[model samples]
Target: MANKKVHTSALLEKAGIPPPESISSSVVNEIQQFRKVQPTSKELVDGILNGNVTALSRAITLIESTNATHVEKANEVINACLPYANKSVRIGITGVPGVGKSTFIEAFGKYLTGLGKKVAVLAVDPSSTISHGSILGDKTRMEELVKDKNAYIRPSASGETLGGVARKTRETITLCEAAGFDTIIIETVGVGQSETAVHSMVDFFLLLKISGAGDELQGIKRGIMEMADAIVINKADGDNIKKANLAKTEFNRALHLFPAKKSGWIPTVSTCSAITKEGIEEVWKTILKFLEVTKENNYFFEKRKVQNLFWMMETINEQLKLNFYNDPEIQKLLDSTKKAVTTDEISPFAAAQLLLKKHFKK
Candidate 1:
């Protein structure tokens, strides 16, 4: 037994180790300095106005947070930044899945930055319903723009918002504007109905299309085409250039059939090759012309006022629905009400009325 103990000691010595008698002083110091201090609303506002990207990112995170505790502070930050907002040219871009949206955006954004414009791109990615997660891949796709000092790219999850945008997208735009971005581009998940949501918040709506895609307009909805301020047929390089021109002609003809827009500016159609960076300048010129005409006719400010009113009403409606659904009594009743409806024990309308009454009474 003594020899065995001696052998174990020898092995321990060869293994080269001993327990620490005390924690190192540097480790102790690190532990003492680890407390995180949250920035106040004023600080966040100041940083955003000063064009601090870190502050801008934190402010956006606060705005997007679902926590009730962050609501007051987020509102304070937004209110503080409101005076600096609304100066940027907001544009919305939408297209079907395979239309090379990221490629086009990178090229277009680089062009804007080249013209000494500070550009912000807000790309919304669709979330998986089951996992409630999204693959925010805009940064990966927009490699060149990601490195541009004058460009900022943010990818947000759609989070069950039916319109292919994040719920806080408008607020994000405001923050970007406050951060001195001269141009703001909202990129939506390439799905139908998202176009309407994008159209409501942006001064100009651009629809990106490609050629040799089935019926040329197969997947696009008529309402979306009507909403577009401009439609650009992308991939107009090399062999596909002819096909793109043909698509542009057909689109222009289709657009003429629609009634005149309230803005009094005729919608334009153009073809561009995002890969070769051709015709981008023409597209930007078209946008500038639309802005000039709209501002002259007083439609620019008028549209913004109407949109603000619409958003206010939308917020109220959303809050009311949230309050109704989040009530404990309503949640308990909803489970049974669904079964009752399925079993023919109660009509859907009657169940809804019951739930509403309970919600209001409580």
Candidate 2:
């Protein structure tokens, strides 16, 4: 009876059965030795400086964490890593969904790794609107690069907004640079204004394209063209090679219409076959040439300085918005204020002022 199943209605059998123990002493003892303790910020900093990938990943996770407890620790790690950052070349890549971005990135990353460069790729994966979950399939797609000892790929979700992901990525770049990665490739989700956000954070912006039918120039955004340091026409292999060259010529003609860049660097058009790995070396050579030019004129250094200032102001704006919405007084009155504004009982500006006053009073 003790080993057999007993129904609750059978009181005699049920009461006769002994209760389970409160804690499994043997299981607890076995688990205790393997428990992971959170490393300190100093430990993370030292590990990152010593080229430890595990510590670098943990530091990035702390930066992306929404918990309040992680904020201070994250800040400490960043501050410690700041001196070691900015030694790498930060490149941003974006393109339409079918343009073979992953293929090109993997090929490019492998080429860089072959050149003895430690590369870190931060690929932004699209999140489902309904479930808010990301595919994070970059590692799977870039099988060769994923296995390379000189390369590290981290795929992140484009969460509710691009600003959050951009900020996290920017910080991640610093951590990667500190961890001995000399080349940082940031891959955008290739939707909406993600390209603009990524462009602002990177030193070089690459717009990947593929030759298509007779509409090579259709639906291309003028702003994106202006931002490109180079437009790489990918999939230039087999029968597509001719069309790729034609597309390149058309793009170069279109690029000539844009005003000269402040950096005085002419944007180049190149064709590459990610599958065949043809013309991949030209892209790296072009980047090196750009670095030589930009460094000669000091534009590279000045641009980075300006970017740091812009991010400082951006961070201030983000903090102000977060604090205003998270305030206790504002939280209490937010619903009423929003309702009043929606129903025309109060002006939006006036309701905002009231909330600000209430929040400030506290």
Candidate 3:
């Protein structure tokens, strides 16, 4: 009578009934059939060069993959597409949350496509810091533009600072340009470091503004205002028009306070209603004028060259950090090292040196 044997399996069922495999088998077959054909790097390159959006999307998905196995294939695709890139006009757009960026972009993209410009939009959706999940809803918001044969919209989740917003962005743009998009619109998740990241990747930067929302410049970051090539006051139709105009004037004055841009292009403030499509055309005109001036002064090409250099350096930094963290030995020590620093067992600097020393000892 010392002890009795306990049977946990009896708490449920003696033999669990398996879910119907017959139903799932057909679905699995269909999925396998769909995934059966993954095009080669040369095929993807040829398709992208011929303006194939399917190939372009697949290539971008590969670039975004976190799996190390996909890296080589993604790089091959990017290298193949590079020669056709750097030819498109890169525009970076940013605004605060609830600033109507999606509507404005839809209208602006439609206007661009109407003028026979092949447009590609890389829209970054906000991701949660805790869960790190992103909502890619730009396609739903941009119904008309999504349907246009000449326009392509690819929505990515902003890992905020995990290098998700910046990594592979250049490659995505290159792939889009290779797919013959004359205009590349990079839409940031919101008004933050994402704007700064996107600003570095594009030739022109646009900051979208809204009116009747406290002081016109209250929440605006000075760095963003400075980076903006243009500030567009959105939702300018009807009763909001007057307020929008007033905000535009304030912004124009604020823009003047900053030092002149190196490209010699004065940033302009304009108003537009995405629903009414008013002033959308003018926004394009402003971009065109910016391009004209930058190109004439050779600033555009020079900026591209500088951006290439920045990206090269950024890639090296990211790769080195990734390699360091991904090293088996570092992975083993990272948690304990952090605990040591937090618990006063080791100073932060000393802890970092310890980790680095251990990592580089090879």
Candidate 4:
């Protein structure tokens, strides 16, 4: 009975009701500090399960950090939040330069939030670097949506190596879901391999294209088109409407030539004008419909379980590689191995095995 009462009380608190003053001061202080700095694994799990937004954001930052010390903590947080993750729809949006990704995202996000949905935008900006401040200029592009209280926008921080994508994006999605965000939007840097990274983490991949005279299809890469579950031709208003219609037909035809995705979801090509806010809702409806079909077919949970395993394997590989390169003794051997290969004293494969044997004690 006591346990049941406690659970009920916590549920009430999570619903935004203030808990009794008898709640432990230590937990309160921990929550406060978690708001200021990154939380420990336990704190993050507790805070997220309790629907604390600050804790979720801090936990995401912890996972994003390349610092070796945070790896174990990040793993713990992910493991704890695993059950709560994958409940939200994960959508990845990518486009080439000047495609109005930010504008479209804002319009789409605001539309969702207006429908009483909690939306989180995990935006990855590849153009920025540590040496120079993140242009962060795109956030400005989302002029109206930035002011919405229900939307959470996180820009890719400086120095992240995976094409401005925070390595912890998968974990971040978990954190957001645990915080009760119903929809999670991952905005990739929209060039080259970044889209691939985004595609791996999302349930649906959306490729944005600009309609140009005789050159609409010319802008997109074939590989990207193959990966997309939906291709949205943006900037579809005003003078481009005719071109946009033509582009949509072109994309619809192009989609037919490729085999269906492994997910068995047919790619849909549509048009939207971020400027005029046309067709934005239709694009969202398509996303929700896809979710419905996948969920009904049991593909949704299966895919998420596979993605979780992929997350663990990728993290382990990254940590092992980091440890190998960061060890001073290993570095010395690696230098010698490189020299041996350069001088033809050892084959590349033999030199690699030799270094592994020396460092791994195998």
lDDT of each: 0.90, 0.88, 0.87, 0.80
Model 2: weakest 10-residue lDDT segment is: 6-15
Summed over model 4, clashes come to 0
User: TM-scores, in order shown?
Assistant: 0.88, 0.87, 0.89, 0.80
For residues 49-162, write the lDDT of model 3, one tens digit per residue. 998888888889998876687788999999888888888899998889899989999999999988999999998877887898977899999999999999999998876453
Which residue pairs of candidate 1 clash?
none
Residues 1-362, candidate 4: write the lDDT tens digits. Answer: 35554334433435576657888899999978856665568987898888776777778777776677777788788888878766788998888877888999999999999999889998876644546456656567876777787888877643455643666677788888878888999887765754577766788889898887356556667888888889999998888899888999998988999997666689898999987889999998999898888888888778877877887898788778887888788877777778889999999999888777776883
Cα-lDDT of candidate 2: 0.88
Ten residues in a row with the worst lDDT in model 4? Answer: 4-13
> Cα RMSD to native, each candidate?
6.2, 7.4, 8.7, 14.2
Superposition error at 332 for model 3 (Å) = 1.4
Model 2: pairs clashing at backbone N, Cα or C within 3 Å: none
Q: Which model, 2 or 3, shows the larger lDDT?
A: 2
Count the clashes in each prediction.
0, 0, 0, 0
lDDT of 1: 0.90
Clashes of 1: 0
Which model scores highest in TM-score? 3
Q: Which stretches of candidate 1 lie over 4 Å from their true place?
A: 1-36
Sorted on TM-score, highest at the top, how do the candidates line up?
A: 3, 1, 2, 4
